[model samples]
Structure formats: C-alpha cells, structure tokens
Target: MVKVKNLTDKEYLYGHKACPGCGLGTIGRLALKILGERTIVALPASCMSTVTTQYPQMNYSVPSLTMAFAGTGAVLTGMSAGLKAQGITDVHVLGLAGDGGTADIGLQALSGAVERGDDFIYICYDNEAYMNTGVQRSSLTPIGANTTNSPSGTASYGEKKPKKNLFEIMIAHRIPYAATASSAYPYDFMNKMEKAKSIRGPRFIHIMCPCPTGWGFASDLTVEIGKLAVETGMWYLAEYENGKVRMNVISKTLKPVEEYLIKQRRFRHLTEDTIKLIREHRDSEWRIIRERWVLSKC
Candidate 1:
C-alpha cells in the first residue's frame, strides 16, 4: 500500500497551464511522483500536450515527447524498443492521453502496441468528451451528457450511447496489468501505478478525471465530483490481471445516480424519466460487477 508520505517530494510535472482544478493536472503531477524522473513520456495532441509543451518552457521535468493525436502507443512502443536496443532497462516508457486519443483515434495504434507486448504504461485520463477539441462527443462519452455534438434538445438527449467499456476491451488483450482509477482516490491510484511500474509488459490505467471547464462544474468541486461519480456507481475502481478481476472499492449500496449527475451541467438537462433510466443502467452494471468481480474487502 502506498501512502502520501511514500511519494517523492520532487515535482517531475509542474508549472503547466492546465485550467484551475483540472483533474488531468493532478493526475500528471501525482503520476510523476510515483514514476519518478526515470521516465520517458509520450503525449498525444490533447489538453495535457497543449498545456505542458509551450515553446521554450516545458512543464514536464522528465524527457517527454508530444506525439500526434493518434500516435501515442506507437511512440511509446518505439521509445521502449529504442531504449531496449541500447540495453537501457532502468527507465520507464509512459503514454499519457485523453479519452479522445485513447478510445477513438489512437485505438488502433494502442491495439498494435499491446498485441506486440510492448513494455510501457498507457494512462488514459478520461474527461468524458473531446475536451481539447471543443467538447465534442467521444466514444467514451456517457449517455445523457450534453456535448457540442450531442446536445440536449427536443429531438436529442445528449450522448445516446453508453460509455464504451474500455477497461474490459483492454483486459481482453490480457495485458500484464490493467486498472480503473479515479482522481479522487489518490492512494488507490498511486498504489496501482506502483504495481504497474514493477510489471514488465503492457499496462493500462484508465482514470476518471473530471473536467471543471468542460463538465461545467466549479473548479473547486473537481475532487468532489469525481468522488460522487464513484459513490453513485457511474464509475468504479477495479483491476484485471492474471485472468482475474478484483473490485477495489465495492459498496453494498450505491448513492443515487441523480446525486452525481445533477451536479454537472452536462447532465442537468436530464429529466426524471432519463434519470430513472440511468439509475436502472447503473444497477444493471453493478449487478454484473458484483457477480463477476472478486470483491476486495477494503
């Protein structure tokens, strides 16, 4: 178990231009504290990339590459291979991408890298929409969340599709490690990163990062909103490894889905009927989780 005290005091990621209360910003800093300076990171054309890679002033203290929107996995693979070719093993290769990059455009590249069993860590910080590109809907965007492309109106109801099952999709590849994390739960996320760091093959961590600017929430409420998402079962914490699954934060009873949804401007347009439907879907998902995943007694 990793405590806050166990983390390094050095700031490997800092002085970025991320919006105030940005969950992605917190994730970058905390992840670097865990991964340390001995890492080479690849980022796609997303918010993190735009904010961290200003000319003549890189926010990332470690070696970092700003890759094309769809080339994160490929870049990481090449970096790892090049390092290994040089007999370098002490450094880690990491890919930091947003939902748009991970679940949509970069999916093919990621699939190839994982299939090749590349030694790297790919962390997708999901803000639930194409935030870096004007809040357009992405495949990982949840049902009933209003976006530029999925607006709530007379004939529309925000995004019509459920959030894609990205964790399971990655798990199907049977990578050495995969975990779902939340920005609200730093200890759990840190411990998972530590575990992934010690592993040798493909690793994935999907973090539910709430966006204050994109999600229409107050900046100060970022952590609260993230916690509410988990508490209400809109998101969960779990891991898949060695052909098994474990639920990291299991709750016998979930808070009302409305409690989580109503706070965000994206979901505020949802009516009672839609909220009911959302609750039903959440219940169904939880049933599947409880039946299939090994519940860790936390």
Candidate 2:
C-alpha cells in the first residue's frame, strides 16, 4: 500500500449502525479517508443515508447533504454550482448513491449531471440491488441472478437482462472520466476517487460493495465474494475516459462464475442450464468490451 503524506483520519468514525461485514460501510470509510475533511458528499436515500442520518451522529465528518432517492445527481450538480459561484473551488464534490438509486430511479438525473459536465464525482456503491428496499432487483443486478423482485420462481426470469452498460452510457455522454471500482481493492477505489477529484468535468465511479444480508452469504464473505466476481469475469474492471474505452483491471486468469455464484443463496436455485447461460453471457460481454477497447486503441 502506498503511503500518503496526509491521510485524513477516518471521517466515518467507528460505532456506526451498518450491518456486520457491510463492505459499503467499510469501503465508504476508506473513501472518506482518502477524500479528507475538505470533501462534501451529496448522499441519497439508501443504506448509506442511514449511516449519515442525524441519529447515527452523521458519521460523515465533512458536511453531507442528503437528497431524495432520485435526486443525487441533480443535487450534486446544484451543490457544485453553488460552491463554484462562491469561488470555493478547493472542496471535492461527490455524489454517493446505491445501485438502485444510480441505475434505475436516479438515472436521468445522473445522465443530466454528466451531460452538463458537472464538475464533481458521482460514485455508486453498487450492492447489485435495492438492499435498503428489501433486496428488490435493480438494473445493476447480474443476469441469471435472483433477487426478491427478480425471483428465480419467475414472473418471467431472474434478472433476465444483463447488468446495464453504465460505463458505456457514460461514454455516450463523452464525460471526462468514468470507471468501476470494488471494495475488495481499497487502493484502486481510492485511486479512482483521487483521479476523479483532479478532473474538471463530470466523473463517475461504479464501486462494487457486497451485501451479506441480501446476498445470503456469510457476513465475513463479503470481501471474498467481491473479489470472486472480478476473478470470474462476471464483473470486468473498466473505464471510459475522453470517449475511449479501456479495461483497467484485466483478469488474466478467469475463475468459474459458479465459484462466485454457488455460495450465494440467491443463486441457490439456478439450474446448470441457467448457469451455463450466464457463463456464456459473461464471456461474450468480455470479448465485446475487449475488442472494442483494442480497436479503439488502434
């Protein structure tokens, strides 16, 4: 681990209300550590909001403004404008929201913020679903994965579609930067945050944070599962910067998706055929992304 001359004390103090082994809380703490006290986080209605609530003593040491479930992106933009108008350009601005908040309900506001080139970082601590909302399925949920709303029992299918191409979408907007990060790799996450802070226009980081309660795995396995997702190629480490796509974390050795999925009760009912389909989907997606990235480089 690289040593920082001045790493801020954990802005999110101990004795918080997050569930045991909640990767989000731990990673959130690490993120704030990197951002220091000068950063202003615009949070939304998610599990994170609870951590920042008045009752929790607002774990966020720096000032935090809570927004509606779907207004994080817009609110961050407004905050940036207000601060810049006051000639206060030193503080780092961040919008921290969950996958459900970022990928589904808050998407339009997110897109608007990026398109307007808002000078801030929007970081989605993606736990794959609306964990705060009883584990309902969200667009960030992987295909063939089960959720309370996207049950395997089927109104139709288990997360029938693939995780939305959020990085690509950000590319479509030609934002200055967009990338993915995982709690399993704190340094990577922190590095992305630092990079985004230096950039002028809109920047986004999709951070994978595991939910022990919702994923039906042992609380201690949160970090393991997150690392496994990347190893299995189910989640690719990628980024889009200045309209160019690149794979940031390339998994030279692929692990079986089954290794990643079988431990979770959510995928307990997945049949061999379904598992195979998921494997194929992941491989094909990886190929598509890699090919495009390579050609673009050429």
Candidate 3:
C-alpha cells in the first residue's frame, strides 16, 4: 500500500460525511492537511458543500462560508477584501467548487475573481458532471460521454460540445498561477496546492476527480480509473505560470483510449465509429496542448 505523506493539520479527526470512496472528500482531506488551521474555505453548492454541511453539523476545521451554487468566487473575493480591510492577511483564503460550479454556472464569479487577482487559491474538483444534482451534463463533461441529460438514443450526439477549456479561460485572465492536477496522485496534487498558496495574486487549480456514482464505474476503481485518464491522454497533467505552458506528463507510450473508455458504463453505448470520433477529438485537442508555450519571467 502507498503511504501518503503526513500533514501538520489536525482539524480533521473522526466523523465526516462523504460517501464511501468519495474522491472529493479525499481531496478535501488532503488539501486541508496542507492548508492547515490557518486557512478559511469558501465553498459553492456542490458535493463538498453537501458533505461539509451535512444536516446535523459540518466538517471544515477552520471557518467556512457556504455560498450559492454559483457565487463562490465572488463570496471569496468579498471575504478576502473584508479581511484585508481588517488587516488580517495572515490567514489564507481558498475558494473551491465542482466542475459544474467552476466551468459552467460559476464561471462569471470565477472569471471576475481571477481577473481582479483576488488573494485566494480557487480549486475546481472536476467530476465532469453535476453528481450531486442527478448526474446532468456540465460544460466540463467530456464529449461523447453520456450523462443523465445526454443519454444515448435517437436524440443528439451525446454532449455535442467539447469539454470547456477552463485552463485557457484562466490564462485569459492573466492570473499569477494556475495548474491542472489529478486526485489519484496526492503528492503532485498537494505540491501544487502548497505552491499556489505561496503566490501573492490569484491562483487556480483544476483537479480531475473520478465519480463512481456519476461515471457508472464501481467505487473501488476510483483510483485506477483516474490513473487511466492520464495514461490514455484523455486527461493530462499540466501547469502554467507567468503566461507559459508546461505539461508534466505526455506518456511516451499512451494506453489505448479504448481501455479507459470501456471501464465506464457511460461510454458503453459507443460503436466503433463513435469510439474513433472520440479518439480523433482527443488527439486534436492534445496536439494543441503538446506545444511548450514560453513564459516571460517578468
């Protein structure tokens, strides 16, 4: 068994409200481990909100503000501003949400937060669909993937659009730091989290989390499925700073995209043509990201 490194944070102890194998919960547990007691969390309505704010009590070790489904960035920005006005700069503020909360409904507040260079580390744990709300398709959902709203049948080509390019959107804001990570690898994920907080301006972290409930995979396969996402180039590990692109993993020998697809029942309806189409789209997108965009150290 892989032993995850320990964290100094001691807030999380016994009781918590995450479903068994809830990837988001693991992410929160790990993140707060580094963010520690000195941090405050601003969360939008998502799986995290549900888990942390489970009816009888809550799970956040530090102070937290639960904002509307799409207002985490705005709320966090305002909170940070209020704290700044009060000369409370020692506490680190973090705004976090799901992919639906980040890529779609919450984009406006998120964009504004980044553009204004709010002093917070905003994270989106991208489960790709709105899992807490009946597994509907979100802008972050992969093309050709079936969601409750995009089920395969006589209608539509199954989420007709590509996954929204959130990284590009963050880049457009010229934010100080932004990176994409995977939950299956905590070392890389936590390292990025720590690094992002060190910067003075806004920082964005987009983490891919596998959802067994929504993705139609067995819960036990969460880690393996997440790993397959990277091995197949379906999801990649990338980072950006000072306006340049740096990809962390581009497998020398890519695991077939088909292996990754067949694991999830969501893509089970695929015919050979649909599979080919999906791979073609995936590669085309990868081609653009494969280039190393230079950054100015200024």
Candidate 4:
C-alpha cells in the first residue's frame, strides 16, 4: 500500500461548490499542493472553474486565471512567456482543464503549446465525459459508458468509440514529461506533479477523475471507484520520460475489468456482448502498453 501524506493544510481551501465525492476537487487540491504556492493555475471553462472560483470567494489559495474552453494551453504559454520576460523563473505555470476542453475543443491550442515546447504543466482532470456540460459525451468517454449524449438504449450502445489515447497523443508531441494519474493514488499523483514542476519544458498529466453525478455512483464512492479503475487496468498508472515508458508498481497487477465496470451505473445497462467488447478493448490496450514498456528497456 502506498501511504500518502496528509495535505489538509495545502493550497486548496474550504467552502467550494464541487459535488460530494468529486475527484476533480481532490485532483485540484493534491496538484496545487505539489505545485506549491508560487504556481499560477490556468483553468479553462470546466468544473474546476465553476467550483473553485465561485463569486465572492475562491477555493484556490494560489493565483488562478480562468480562460475560454479552448484557451488554456495558449494562455498558459503566454503566461509562462510573460513571467519569463519579467525574470520570474521560479514560478510554475499550471493549466487545468476537463476532458472536453483538453481532448476536444482545446486540442488545437494544447497541441500548439506543446509543439512550441512551452515551460508549463497541463493537467487534464478527465471525468470521462463533459460532466460540467450536462454529462455530455466527449471523445475521452470510454466505450460502453452511458452518458446523456450516448444513451445505452435498445437502438444503440453507449459510446461507440473507445477512450482517446491521450497519453500517446501527449507523448507524440515529444514533451519532456507525460503521465497518467488518479485521485485514488494521491502519492503517485503528487509525485508526478512534483516531478513535472522540476522539469523545464511542456509536461502533461491526464487524471481520471470520477464523478458521482455523471457516472451515477454513490457520492461517497469516488475514491473507491478510482481505485477500482487502476486495479482493473482500465486506467493505468504510467509515465513517459526521455523516450522511455515506465508503469507504476501498483498498476502492474490488474484485477478483472468487471470488478471496475459493475461499480459504475454508467455501465450497468451494458449487454454481455458490450462487456466483452470492453474487455477486448482493455486487453488490447494493455498489450500495447506492455509492448511499450518492453521497448523502453532497450
């Protein structure tokens, strides 16, 4: 078991609007804690923006900038440049966005920033779909997940496509650091964020945050669901550095996918065939990841 230190006195403050058991809030807290007070957070239009910056009071202890849904990466690049011009080399720039903002609408700006090799860290807290926008389906929504847009009725299955290979996308950009993280493993998440802070180029962390309202799970199952995701190999914990890939020790041994699927109501109405399809997809992806790990050893 990985013992994570308590960060109750960190950057995240009390009195926020996030739903009970929302992992996005946990992600924000842990990430900010690791990035430290000198960090400037850039949030695109997402759940974090709404909950963290409610009128009259803000939950974030550090400075935060709210931007358009597709402007996070671009704005962060500018912020980093501005800080550099002002001779503020010690401050870190952190960009926070949802799956919709990062994988879909914000992909262009993010790509541009990464291609330019901006000095900042972009963290995408993916709750699977556009949870902040009525639980709509986003490209990152996993196959067989029943979102409002991808309803699993007799006429059609849930999401037709598999979750976007976001990690690979980031790696393809040749960023200095890229990793997968989850609120279930706070220590690993914090360690990755801290590592990204130490690096001087563009870094990316894709966090699989669980949403109680969107996934139709009990509000308290956020952490449990996140754990199940890692245990089942649905969400792997891995990092890419210096042209090599390394899987986290805990995620090497995976449990059955069913154990993770059955816990979320989004997959409750899935047919046996759909479950098999999901398993096949998960296994195939795992195989590819294993192959990459092997290559990294060469």
Candidate 5:
C-alpha cells in the first residue's frame, strides 16, 4: 500500500491549464508522484498534451514527449529501445493517452508494441469521449451519453453503442500486468502504479477519468462523479496478472444506475426505458465478472 504520509512533497506535474477539476490532471499528477523523477512521459494529441505542454509555461517537471494522435505506443517502443541501447535500465518509459487515442486510432500501434513485449508503461486515462476535440464520440463512449457526434434530441437518443471492454482486450494480448482504476480511488491507483513499475513489460492500466466539460457535470463534482461511476456499476476496478484476474473493490449492493446517470448532462436525455436497459446491461456484466474473476477481500 502507498502511504499518504510517505508520498513526496515534490510536484512532478504542475503549472498546467487543465480544467478546474480535471480528473486527467489529477491522475497524471498521482501517477508521476508514484513513478517518481526517473520517468519519461509520453502523450499523444490529447487533453493532457494540450494543457500541460503549452508554450512559456510547461507543466511536466520530468522529460515529456508529445506524439501524434496514433503514435503514443510507437513512440514508447522507440524510447524503450533507445534506453536499452544506451544501457540505461533505471528510468521508466511511461505513455499516457486518452480513450480515443487508446481504444480507437492508436489501437494498432499499441497492440503491436505489446506483442513485441517492450518494457514500458501505458496508462489510458479514459474520459469516454473525444473530449480534446469538440466533444466527439469514441469507441469507449458509454451508451446514452450525448456527444457532439452523437447528439440526443426528439429525433434521436444519445449514443446507442456500449463502451469497449478495453481491459479484456489488454488481457487478450497476454500482458504481464494490467489493471482498471478510477481517479476517485487514488490510493488504489497509486498502489497499482507502484506494482506495475516494480515488474514491467507491456504493462497497461486503464483509468476511468471523468471529464466535467464533456460529461456536463460541475467541476467540483469530478471526484464525486467518479465515485458514483463505480458505486452504480458503470465502472469497476480490477487487476490482471499471471493469467488470472482479481477484483479490487466489490460493492455488496450497487447504487441505482439513475443515481450516476442523472448527475451528468450527457445522460440527461435518457428516458426511463433506456436507463432500464443500462441497468440491465450493468447487471449482466457484473454477473460475468463474478463468475470469471477472483473476488478480492479488498
């Protein structure tokens, strides 16, 4: 476990322009706090890159690289190889990308890198939509959430498709270490990051980072909304290692899907029937999880 008192006072990521309560910024700061100074951060053309890499006021204290939208994984691979060529093994190569970059266009590059078993850490901070570019929809966007590309009105409901199961996809590649995390659970996220750093080859961590701007929630509600996501079964926390999966946090009884859905404007347009469908879907998914994953006491 990562003790709060033992955490360093130094800020590795700061002086940025992220939203007031941006979960992406919070997760980035926490991740680097765990990874420490010996880390090379890489991000694609996403919210983190846009906010942190602005001219005249850089945010990242550590070495950071901004790559093309579809090249984060590829860049990490090269960074790892370059470090190995120079016989430098202590530094960690970390890649941070948003949902669109990870689950959509960048999937091929990421899959290729993982197949080669490169030594690097890839963290996908999923905000569920293309929040960096006009609130467009991505593969990871949940059903009934309104995006600019998937507007909801009298003519249409919000997004009809379900969110992509990214964790399972990473497991399919047989990654040595992969975990699902939420910004609301910072300590758990930190512990997972520390573990990934300890032993790593194509490690991946999928973090559900709620976007207040895109999700149509008040900035102050970012953390509260994140917690609600897990409480309502819209998101989950788990880890995969050694060909096995384990649940990290399990709720004996889930809060109603409406409790989470009503807070976000994206889901405001959802009718009772649609919400019912979503609840049913969540229940079905949880059933699969209960059957397949090793339930942890935590």
Candidate 6:
C-alpha cells in the first residue's frame, strides 16, 4: 500500500460541492497544503471554480481569481508580473485548469506563457475528458474509452485517437520544470508542488485525476483507480528538467494494462483487438520514455 501524508487540517474545507470520491477536490486540498496561504490561484472555468467558490461563500483560504476558460495561462502570467513588480517574491502564482481548458481552448495562451518563461506554476488536473461539461470527449481522452461524445457502438469505437501527450508538448517548450503526477500519490504530488514553488521559471505539472461519475466507476474507487492507472502503465509519472527526463521510481515497474482497463466502465466495450492495440501503444510510449530516461543519465 502507498503511504500518503496525513493532512487532517484541510486547506480545502470540508463542505464543498464536489461529487463523492472526486479526485479533483483531493488534488485541490493537497495542492493548497503545499502552496500554503501565500499563494494566488488563477482558476479557469472548471469544476474547481464552481465547487470552491459559489455565490458569496468560498472554501479556499488562499486568494483565488476566476478567469475565462481559455485565459488561465494569461491570467497567471499577469499575476506573476504584477507580483514581481511589487517585489513580492515569496507568494506563488498558480494556474489551475481542467483538461479541456488546458489542452484545447487554453493551449495557445499556455504555449505563450511557457515560451516567455513566465515565473509561475501551471497545473492541469486531467480527468481525461470534459467532465465539467457532461463527459464530452476532449483531446486528452484516451482511445477506446467511452465518453458521452465518444460512445461506442457497432459502427464506431470510442475516441478514435489516443490521448494527447501534454507532458511531451510542454517538454518541447524546454521549460525549467515539467512533471506528470497522479492524485493517488499525494506525497509525490505535494513534493512536486513544493519543488515547483522553489523554481524560478515556467513550471508545469499535469495530474491524472480519475472521475468516478465520468469514468463510470464506483464512487469510492477514485484513488484505487488512479493507483491502478499508474501501476498498469496507463499513466506514466516523470519529471523533465534542463532538457532531461526521469521516470518516477513508483512508475518504473508496471502491471498489465488490462488490470487497469477492466475496472472502468468506459473501457468495457473495447474489443480484444482494441485492447491489444492499446497495449501496443502503451509499450511503444514506454520505450520512448525509457530512451529519454537513459539519455538523461548521460
């Protein structure tokens, strides 16, 4: 069993409007704990925005600003600049967005921010699809998974293309730091956030947050599913620094992808050939990662 650090005093308050076993809320709490009170979060039009702040009541202890769905990156850039002008170097500026907000609508702004070497942390809590908009298929949705927009039937299999490799895309920008995290591994997530806090230039962390409602899993199995994803090699945890990549220790050993896919109802309709295809793709990706890891050592 993985040991997670106990954070009994929740930075994300107990009474939020998130669904049961929602990994996004857990991610918010863990991130807030690491970021502390001296942090400003720029939230996009994601579930995090609605659940944390509704009408007059807000659950967050730290300052948060909501922006347009496609403007979180720009907002963070502005916040970072403003703080720098005021000589307020201690406070961390963070941008939080969902997969759709990050990978699709907000991609341009994000690319611009990273290209300019903005001093801020950008986090994308990817639940694999547009969960906030009724489980529509987004660019980040994995192939053969059933979302509302990518339903499987006799004529069509789920998402036709594989999930977008956002981490690789960020790495191509040659930013100071980039990492892939999972909500199941709170220690790893917190550690990465703490490290990003100390870094100077553009840093990005993509966290895989399993959604119980969207993924058609037991409400209580969010963390379990997240762990299985990493264990089964469906999700790879790694960090990129100074043009080098290193896979996390926990993700070095992996189980079969079937173990992970079988649990989620989204992948239930996948045919044997489709499963094999996914496995092949996963192995190929791992090989590329391994190559990168080896090159990082030299």
The prediction achieving the highest lDDT against the true structure is 5
What candidate 6 gets wrong by more than 4 Å, as runs, is 1-14, 251-253, 295-298
What TM-score goes with each of the models?
0.98, 0.93, 0.93, 0.94, 0.98, 0.94
* Model 3 C-alpha lDDT versus the unseen true structure: 0.82
lDDT of 1 by residue, 28-93 (tens): 888888999899999999999999998989998899999899999899899999999999999999
Report the lDDT tens digits of candidate 4 across residue range 143-174: 99998989999998889999998999998987
Cα deviation of 81, candidate 5, in Å: 0.1
- Stretches of candidate 4 above 4 Å error? 1-8, 249-253, 294-298
**Among all windows of ten consecutive residues in candidate 4, which has the lowest summed lDDT?**
1-10
On lDDT, the stronger of 2 and 5 is 5
lDDT of 3 by residue, 1-298 (tens): 1135356637552256666766887788777777778888888889888878876787776888888998988987898898899999888888869999999889999888878878988889999999888899999999878888998876655776778889888988888898888898777888888888678878999999998888888889999999999889788777788778777774566787899999998888787888888899888877776554532211
TM-score for candidate 2, please give it.
0.93
lDDT of 3 at 141: 92
- TM-score pick, better of 2 and 3: 3
Best-first order by lDDT? 5, 1, 4, 6, 3, 2
Regions of model 5 farther than 4 Å from truth: none
Lowest summed lDDT across 10 adjacent residues in model 5 is found at 246-255
C-alpha positional error of residue 190 in candidate 3 after TM-score superposition, expressed in Å: 0.5
Candidate 6 residue 230 C-alpha distance from true site, Å: 0.8
lDDT value, candidate 5, whole model: 0.93
> How far does residue 253 in candidate 3 sit from its true spot (Å)?
2.6
Per-residue alpha-carbon lDDT of candidate 2 for residues 3-40, written as tens digits (9 for 90 to 100): 56556655554556878888877666877776777888
RMSD of 1: 0.9
Better by lDDT, candidate 4 or 1: 1
Residues 1-298 of candidate 5: C-alpha lDDT, one tens digit per residue: 8998989999999888988888988899999999999999998999989999998777999999998999988999999999999999999999999999999999999999999999999999999999888899999999999999999999878898899999999999999999999998899899999999998689999999999999999999999999999988899999999999998765778899999999999999899999998998999999999899898755
